[model samples]
Target: MIKHDVSHFPTILVFNTTEKDKTSVALIKNGSVKISEKSRRAQELQSIVEELIDNNHIEIGEIKAVAVLEGPGSYTGIRIGATTGNTLHWLYRMPVIVIPGTDISEAAERLMSGEEFDVTTYFSPRD
Candidate 1:
């Protein structure tokens, strides 16, 4: 039995696959983003996680859930982030939540407007 003392605030791991040139993962604790980073390759993802853990002084076991960008972007980027999130979830028994990048943008728009707005997202491969 592993004992984890996750703070009562929400903790989220956000991944972005919106652009091939830019991939990012963010760690949010208590509604505050503690760490955010970008990497280009799958091999670099783990290192970013390690850096976040080290820099934020957080334990891997302390993460309560993972919030990953589900896609409509680079397939390989999504796979990399999803694989990493899933692995962590399996190892720590934490919850995994997925949010599309469009949804995030829509939410931001709604917050800014204080009114509901129709939102649509499209993705196309880069040639």
Candidate 2:
């Protein structure tokens, strides 16, 4: 469930932990990107989020949504990402958009549109 907030700057927190032992987070604020990814995803997820948020000067009220990569990939990675997104949803009462993880391109396209990609095969419905 997403609560509408007109008082704050709308920002999306996008994260993908679909690959094994690799995690990445992207905080999209005002067309600026604060992102980090490494093999240390598990150990660094929280810190990465903090760094992105702090560096971007995002307040709790500024977060409009959290978009996370839902998986056809690593179970642990998906679980961790889901957990973090859920935590954010609980804390902020913002909507959590679960993006299908078949390709990062779709999510990226949705986040910011300028350049375009050729369409590929459509994915199945989420299980």
Candidate 3:
């Protein structure tokens, strides 16, 4: 298990794609939203996140965890967000926390408590 002490590393990369037409990416620090960007271009999600990180001068490693807002919104958007979060988890070995709603504080609490969720298991498209 990874140590997710927010005080040690307060930066958390958040992805909120629960909206029908737009995707939101944010840098969260110390339980507060630091910087954020929204895009209607769902296909540009990856680039948007990259640019946001770059613009904020936040390194990938500096992010304590990846918090993804899972569903109750756009299907495709949710898929994209989860996939990106999972990819980041795999590539960088960062912990991925799935937020069922838009609550960032709740996710932070879960992280602090060391409650782990399988990021990949949350998204399964209904056929």
Q: Which candidate leads in TM-score? A: 2
TM-score of each: 0.67, 0.72, 0.71
Clashing pairs in 3: none
Q: What C-alpha RMSD separates each model from the true structure? A: 9.0, 6.9, 4.4
Off by over 4 Å in 3: 1-9, 102-127
Task: Judge candidate 2 against the unseen true structure and give its global Cα lDDT, from 0 to 1.
Answer: 0.64
Candidate 1 residue pairs in backbone clash: none
lDDT of 3 by residue, 1-127 (tens): 2323333447778787777667677777665564455647566788878888888776888886787877677788778887887788778877676666754455555545545554432334341
Ranking by TM-score: 2, 3, 1
| Residue 110 C-alpha lDDT in model 3 | 59
Winner on TM-score between 1 and 3 is 3
Highest-lDDT candidate: 3
